[model samples]
Target chain A: MALATLKNVRFAGMATCVPRRILSNINDCPPSLRSERERLVRNIGIETRRICQEWQCLSDLAYDAANRLIDQLGWKKEDIDGLIVVTQSPDYLIPSTAIILQDRLGLEHTTIAYDVNLGCSGYPFGLHLLGSLIATGSVRKGLLVVGDKSATIKDPLFSDAGTVTALEFRENSNPWFFDLNSDGSGFKAIMLPVGGHRNPVKFFHLIPSEDEHGILHLPTDLILDGTAVLSFSTQRVPPAVEKTLAYANKKIDEIDYFLFHQANKMINETIRKKLRLPEERVPSTLKEFGNTSGASIPVTITARLREKLTEGSKQLLLGGFGIGLSWGTAIIKVEEACLPELIEA
Target chain B: MEEFIEKFQEAVDFQDPVEVTENTVLLDLPEWDSLAALGVIVMFDIEYGKTITGDHLLKSKTIKDLFELTVA
Candidate 1:
């Protein structure tokens, strides 16, 4: 249980960008799977998703989001003392996306910048880091950019998104609470088996294997064990959220919204029921965003709760789980001005 | 667990739901595939209040074995 609470740092504002190109799963379904398409769509909660264009990458979306947020908040680029981009998909293996973003966003040269490679649980995890940095007073304000284009292939399992969240020092003593956990033993539960240093892509990695449904995927392709992920979600997330709420001294009814990672419909519904939250309080973007990896939570926030969050101050309980077999829960107060318009690129 | 066979028959998609039995081997059914396996997990979670992993579904040789795991 990796848990911590920090003070004097609140989520200042947030903006998200999803590509304009949409892919409808109905059209993507093949002849054999046509009959099961409706049921699959209902279970997954993804009928259509935004897939990026060939010229676009996660960085492009993240940059667009960051640029919009900075402009919305009317902050000088020099005032952004830190920048961190969290994602598994990077433009290159060498230069960190944060460094490139710093140059692209025109932030001061003295700003702290880097990247954290994570998926699914990356949003609250990014918040955890930003809270720690702001508490240390080494940086007055920072930008945490999270985005991913993990499903730029033949799979309808994921959609692309980028989110930028502003974290700044505030005079208010409001606390930001986070609970982070990881089970690396189950790292293979959701992963790309090849293309890393441990398992470089070889010729055989490109070889395709047919599943029972006759879907063919290369060995290098990202794999998702639905049952395994579901089991983990059912067993882990509720407890983590409950424990974090206790740590933050919050009651369930006191929360205005419980924004969970938009992994899909089934897993999220199960968790929501277990937590006894009504449907209206739990917003989902799976139908449009389709598991945007680390960007899921923020993307869902920007897509579904943009109006509610921008209208007034609200207490939010955010939970994210998957990949790394990791889970994170955060309870915080998001003020009315802390939300920006959802940007579409 | 008496309704297990009926549930399995529905998800298995056999021509006749009556043909499914506790003793029926899962892979022997034409409809028993990855999708069916996931459906089984969902059924156990929602109906039986059991969390079944993919490995557990694969290890269960027959409908009876899966039903018993739901109890276990």
Candidate 2:
């Protein structure tokens, strides 16, 4: 059980950026999916999603969001001592995206910058990683930029978006409790089949292939074993939520909101129902943003509960799971965090 | 078995016109896709409190085979 309580770190604010191009799962669905579009939309719970232009990358969105958040928080670029970029859709395989983002954001040379390869679980995991540095007095302030340009091959299942979370060192702040777990055995549940070091990209991998469903995808594209993911998420997330609450000595009712990674409507609803949480407590970005991968939880917060989170203090229980078959839950208080409105690029 | 058939039909959202039975070849159904498989998995989890994997769904030739997997 990778459970810990980090103290003295305050969530300053967060901002999110999505491309201006929108793809409606209903109106923009391909001909192959046209027949079952309504059923797909209803079950998946994503009516529309933002997509990136060809020139855009995950870093571009993240850069915009980080700039906006820094400006909103009134933080100087020189003061940001740590930069953590978490994503599965990085710009390059050579240099870590964080290094590039550090330069792009014009942060000081003393800032610690790197990247963490993760998908849905990236947000909470990134917080734990960066918050540690802040808590230890090694870094006074840090930026956690998490995003994914997951709209590969124009697949409606994934969306493109970036989010930046600012955390500052504060004295006697409320402790943030987290329960994180991972299962490498279930890595195949959600993954790109090829293009990695183990399965190096080849000419054949670049060729588009058709699955039984008649949807065409390259071998390097994300292949989701829906049944496996559904089972893992529905079973694993509920217990993880319970464990986090227990770790924090908090009860379900004490949580003002439960923000889950907007993987899909069906998977999220299953987890919510298993936990017996009311519909209103669990805010979702699935309808507008679809599955924004790592950025989903914060994206949901900025899109749905901006006014509430920006105005008053709220206890939030966040659940993020999938891709690495990894899942984690964090219990934290949003004390008037500067949650800006969603930005369109 | 009759109850299982009805539950399976509902899980897959098959219309009443398309009758399903114990011997019904599930793969033959036009709606039998990854989404339907996910539905059945969720159905088993919610209704029977059983965990069924994609392999179990793929290997089960008929609705009876699927129900038998839940027999335990």
Candidate 3:
């Protein structure tokens, strides 16, 4: 007798938030500063950036995206049985962002709401988590919100954005084959030096310094060893993708589209080359928007889906990797979903 | 002396006067938190190579105690 095989899961609806405020790569800084960081920004594959206003928070961006998704699908907030927000940025340091989003969306008290602290790889991980909960009959419908306000870093490398995806449980759906990996050793590759229990903020006084590049340094700022991160991504991501495809009993050629975390233009291109994916099949948003951390992959998917890029695509190999030194990939089929466009009000 | 106090006040975003008379409870200030503790620790560590932990913070109650800890 043959073993029972689960059917493939499908994406239903998607929405993304890109802040109205645009910060151009050259205009944000003076001409003198531009010449120095121009090559760096270009090498990273960022063009224009988006950021939330002074009063807006990560939850606000997420709420907007989720609301858009609900409006487009014509589904009530009560229809969502589970809500998971994958974010490192929260309105408050204590209460989880997911709970805040739940309240903002007017979800019922019975809805499961929680926040998962992740960075770039959050989207795929969030999907896997949602799929598992729904597949087990725990929840019929789920909302996965991946958002980040890397703008708090005050660095040009990060942008503020969010993406919300709606997942519905079908009677018989294909099991979303997921591959998750993490390496705590590389945690320091991307981190904020202050603002955590590991190093309390009260003990330090701020001092300003200028490095050789004249970049200002402060005690409570985000620091990224760019070279180190790039090297790690280029070396680890392709192999991880290959491993995930093998686990799914699929081949690189079998994947209709490859959705990778929009870390940077070069990194994404490098991974695509290593995977031997056709340039046209790889979806990217890093050129227009800088790295939005957890929101990267979903926002790209939402944008592409809105443009009708994958209307009848059969298979998608999605992967996200960065921060936490974490990586996750999954294969799924796209359904005739009502993907929403950003409505300016 | 006043310059150092001003730097400390600006760093922590505390509006308290820049007077270091020695009785001010550093933790009692409204701006005190784990993040602020880290900011102060790194500031003093970079300046004086003195590392202060949460346990060390619990032992010291006043600004003068912190100064003494660092200078000692």
State the lDDT at A75 in candidate 1. Answer: 90
Q: Which model scores highest in lDDT?
A: 2
CAPRI-style class, candidate 2? medium
Candidate 2 structure quality by residue, lDDT tens digits, B1-72: 989888887777642238788888988887788878888888898789888888988889998899998886
Against the true two-chain complex, what DockQ does each candidate achieve?
A: 0.38, 0.56, 0.01
Say which prediction, candidate 1 or candidate 2, comes out ahead on lDDT: 2
lDDT of 1 at A305: 84
lDDT of 3 by residue, A1-345 (tens): 111122434467888877888887766775665654565565567877788888887778778778878887888878788999888888888798888778879998889989899989888888888877877777778898888888642366688897788898786665677778888898988888688888877644377677765667788777775545665676678877877777788887888778888887666766776677898788788877788898887777776655554365457788888888888777777667767775321
Q: Which stretches of candidate 3 lie over 4 Å from their true place?
A: A1-9, A152-154, A203-205, A210-215, A343-345, B1-72
**Model 1: which residue pairs collide?**
none
Instruction: Give the candidate order by descending TM-score.
Output: 2, 1, 3
| Residues A1-345 of candidate 1: C-alpha lDDT, one tens digit per residue | 477888898688899888988888778777777666755776678888888898888999988888888988899888999999998888888789899989999999999999998888889999988878888897899999988987654566689899999999886757889999989999988988898899998988888989767888788878887778888988899899999999988888888899998888778887888777899999888887788888988887887788877888889998989899889999888886566666778
Q: Can you write out model 1's per-residue Cα lDDT over B1-72, one digit (the tens) per residue?
A: 568888766554433344767888888876576656766776777677777788897788988898898779
Candidate 2, after superposition: displacement of residue A329 in Å? Answer: 0.9
Cand. 3 Cα-lDDT:
0.73
RMSD of each: 2.5, 1.9, 14.7
- DockQ score for model 2: 0.56
